[model samples]
Target chain A: MSRSDNAFNQYLDLVRDNAAVMAKGRPALLEAVNKAGASRLAEAIEAYKPASDEIPECRLDRLFAPDYGVNIARVPMTADVAASFRCGVPQLNSLLAVVANDIFRPTDVLMRNMPEGLTVCSLRQVPAEFEADAAALLADGADKNSIAGAISDALAHDGIYVRVAPRTEIEKAVQIVNIFNSPVPMLTPRRLLVHACEGSKVKILLCDHTQTPAVQHLNLQNVYIRVDAGAEVEFYDIEESSAATHRLFSFRAVQHSDSRLTVNTDFLSGGVTRNEFDISVPGDGAYTSLSGLAIVSDEQICSDSVVLRHLGSHCTSRQIFKNALFDKGRGAFGGRIVVDEAARFTDAAQTNRNILESPSARMEASPQLEIYCDEVKCSHGATTGQLDERALFYMQARGIPRDEAKRMLTQAFMVDVIDNISFEVLRQRLHILVEKRLSGASADCSTCATACHSQAPEE
Target chain B: MEDLLKVENLRAGIDGKEILRGINLTVRPGEVHAIMGPNGSGKSTLSGVLAGDPRFTVLGGSATLAGVDLLGLSPEDRSHEGLFLSFQYPVEIPGVTMVNFMRAAINAKRKYLGLEPMSAADFLKTMRQKRAVVELDNKLASRSVNEGFSGGEKKRNEIFQMAMLEPRVAILDETDSGLDIDALRIVAGGVNKLKTDQNATIVITHYQRLLDYIKPDFVHILYKGRIVHTGGPELALELEEKGYDWIKQEVDNEQI
Candidate 1:
């Protein structure tokens, strides 16, 4: 793109003609977009087209609005945050270059990657209030480089960055919803700069809901992750895009020697969603775990996961994925464990399991290991099969109706990843979701064979 | 009057090996009938078939419970009809808590009898009262079904379920197998408490040890798949004292 290209189009028009700026004048909105070169935000949002018809109303726009008090300037910062001033070769955003995404991405590379030429309409009711706090974020952002260009490099050469300010000591959670009504397929790249202080923890939940009709194209996303020392960070994504949707998310992360990072994704509703997590531990005693689960049903909701250990001794990484198929849904998982020569004494495990609930349902898992380091403990395995008929029989013989029996056993099969959630409320809520999906999709559930065979109406 | 359970010319086995060959026995309500046999005898097979355990194929004859065609029903159907099998080896169910399993079983029986579901309060209250009958630890009632339970504890839990079900026919298949005297008494006591004139019990034990506590008015020696001798409760003493050798000799002599 030429230096004088549409680069500065949205902002130049607004700023060059400053009078009407106040008319569109939502302070918080200005603050969120101001820290970043407004030109960069405008171009990214301009090209990102969301693919899906049937868009549902979302509350994210209101959530990020100035009335939501998205003050970037006044938010406090710490030594680590102050260190983020050098977040890049040149620190571009302060709590106050004000910007943008994955650790939510370091500055705003995700916005820059909206599928080329596809216009992703920003969710409406835009937030008008934002206190520029790039410096405040610099005060709390990672002392190390938080303006990660790795992801931007993948999709955009010059790339883009938006400096974001921390609202508080985000402990236990960070929930966000990205709604798309673009009606066209797009590729999105997100870079994350998460710097959790010692003994701190956080959970980030991203809900990607599409309200567009099925476009026969695939959407792509590249996400980068970073966690500081002694900090525990959790990343979760929920995809409710309906049948006829296909998307792939590229997850990459670098964790410090002692920090813990976990990335989990769930497919409650999706047409065809494929996710890959490639994580590395550079810190000694640092750990990275990649785990996910999906209910594979008709159309396509396939998940693929990959875990890698780059460096750091005593580092443990685990990857587990489960898929339960019903009503002709197809699923496949291919996993690899790559251990670098220097990353010795690392304990790693990878397991992929798939269950077929109907004769028409199908699934397969392929687990691989490419370990270059010897004397290092690393392994990978995979298992695939239909539900245990004997287990079903035993459960049925105990008076549990057949469908409820399948639900229980299928739930038990997926219980490993779920029980590890470490939160009671969320875990139980997940079970409820699982129950609803399995029961809603499988009419044969809870009923015996005679009923199921007779009930099949040749649909 | 018809006895509670009657098995005539019962011939059953697994994979073509005959275990119970033409064994005839009868059990009446209010009576504890103990079947004492050697290791390979058909003691467990009878209980298996009675409980509708699908493992064995009944090769011959018939088994009737309370004048109903007992062998024709499914295991769960038989159970709902008040037939209980305190398994020699109880199945371990993980993730399914005891309270939840019990609730399901209780509701299944209630629904079969055309009764409404039990309120949570009544279920819990009944659980509390029955907890004392089987002498179960209050904590265990909330744990997963029979998971990580001691051998004795598993048996007690079986009787505890037996108590909750209040079956008209309970086949205690080696209920006293792993228990110390105390647990044995507790299990037997639970069975005794759930006893009624409308119910009958078939206590299958390898030794006479369990028979002493849960007295049986009728004792039968099941050997080589047939009841060689039947008499009063004293038969159990005779077998325990003389062992199966004399009985085998008597059979051989009679056959010759």
Candidate 2:
């Protein structure tokens, strides 16, 4: 055998022989408990999750109802399982689906953005591949928890980003579908990093989900977006996990000056989806918008938001969070608009409005504003109540069904936030999807439209 | 006479407080009728009860449209049956765009009528023509339904919707409340343009302004919930000049 074969065999021998050594105590680092270079890394792995006392089981009917679709790819994507990644200095950035090379670069992301000495690794292969790469990284003297965290971050970015060419313009919106199928109540961590260059605009739909009839899935994802000057970024992350899971999904961005970041998070599912949006303007005149729409039902879910806006001078930040709940569903909002003591001329506004469709449904919103600057316009407000019964009656009297009227009102409630998505096609497709989801899934398949179905490009 | 709409001794209230004691009226095609009343005389309440605004409870009586039980139908259903209520206060649905709402409404009505759904091109064309009647701006039409609309614009939009629907009987409920002279004229103009000899309009107003523009052939003075007086266009003029005291005194004396 060649020298490379000898090295491969040696690695495999190491993995097979140290199997008992790799299997450690619950929630402990498998191979990094003995590493030397990184002391804080093993302690970080201690933060990993063990199963909670009891498992929370739910019915499949309440999960993927008959009307709701059963997309094959979406199942795993929405679960948003926290896979592993290896942390090393990235060397290559390409736009390929899968690469089997001896390179240290992430070859999937179209435009890779990394600081010096940042290595990107993820669980991108089969079981054997995972074991081999994990063992190799362990041999490289890297700590387990830090590597796990770094891998989570890199996987998050790779998972959410579209891997088209740098110059390839995606006119239609692309959805970042994540799924978690783990039976164990594991603490799945994710970090998404993006750097969109000039004029390359894309709208992302991040759909997170977990399996039905399972214990609670705790998912944690952090997103970092860097839009180069003049590159437009429109992001919409929909957290529709099964009500059996609890998700802590934070989508944060570091926006360069003059780059626009439009973000809309939809919390239509999950047992508890706590979303934190930390957006800061590192450049003068940067624009950031954090808008959201959430629909809750049954004894299901609640979403809390803590938004931090460090808008620089001449920067603008707009926050809108809308919620619609029925039955025992509840939604809570705590948003703060912060302007630095020296962030002069900052314009920021926050609004949290909720519509409760049932007497049992409840919502609480607290919108706050903190401005130390003199020449700034900052405001915050929140309102929570039931859908206007009069409106329902009017529509019903016009021959619309009561349920249909409720759906329409809810749809109308989310319109303001939905309209902010600048991409027309993506906006329409999403609108269609939301209407279907709200109205018990109608028969509108935007993908089946001529524009998408045609062999050639036809809009 | 073929009655297009019939209300028989309709008594209603909100939260058990009786507002509309008993309202009886009949409207047929090719005619315009106006209901004029003083403040809090249940003018808006009548429209609300007719349109099934859930805020009010129907104490008694019923309303029928084109020989169909109008009270049993939903608002969208009533609209499908050509019963349009140009609301006094239209709702502002933040994310639902004007075009989307209209399309949903139009498709719903069409589904009931057993007609094929209109294509996008046709819908846009029809929207354009009807919006012209109200002289609505394209930017406003493209925005969310009634979102950030001024009082006049919302009222005019009601008329524009009335035009788009081409209902059998359009109920203009206090649509003139917040409008200036020009907006009232434009709204009334849109109503008049949409009114064919086949359909009628029920203009609910407190002032003679919208009456002056729409020119209701018959005017009813509702006093303490009932139509105490019904006459020609001159009744609105008389009420405008003399106020509501004469009709109130007449009801009081007749009762006592």
Candidate 2 structure lDDT: 0.64
* Stretches of model 1 off by over 4 angstroms after superposition: A1-168, A178-200, A208-221, A239-241, A297-301, A326-330, A353-363, A379-398, A441-459, B16-18, B252-256
RMSD of each: 13.0, 10.4
Quote the lDDT for A238 in model 2.
Answer: 64
Candidate 1 residue lDDT tens string, A1-459: 333433223233433354343225333322332334333444443443332321111111111111111111222211122113111211211111111211122213323433222111221122223122222332232212111121122122111122122222342233333333333343333323344445556565555544343543233444554565676777776565556445656666668768788777777666666676667677888877777888877655575757586577778887888888888777777787777878788899888888887788766566778777785887777887876655454444455555766777777778778777764545665666676767764321122111101111222
Provide the DockQ value for model 2: 0.48
lDDT of 2 by residue, A308-407 (tens): 6665678888888888887888677778777887677788888888888888887767777777779988878888877777666655544566777689
> How is the predicted docking of candidate 2 categorized under the CAPRI scheme?
acceptable
User: How good is the docking of model 1, by CAPRI class?
Assistant: incorrect
lDDT value, residue A411 of candidate 1: 77
lDDT of 1: 0.61
- Which candidate tops lDDT? 2
TM-scores for all candidates?
0.71, 0.69
TM-score of chain B of each: 0.96, 0.97
Superposed model 2: Cα runs more than 4 Å off: A1-236, A250-264, A277-289, A307-317, A336-349, A364-378, A388-402, A422-428, A442-459, B91-93, B132-140, B147-154, B175-198, B207-217, B232-244
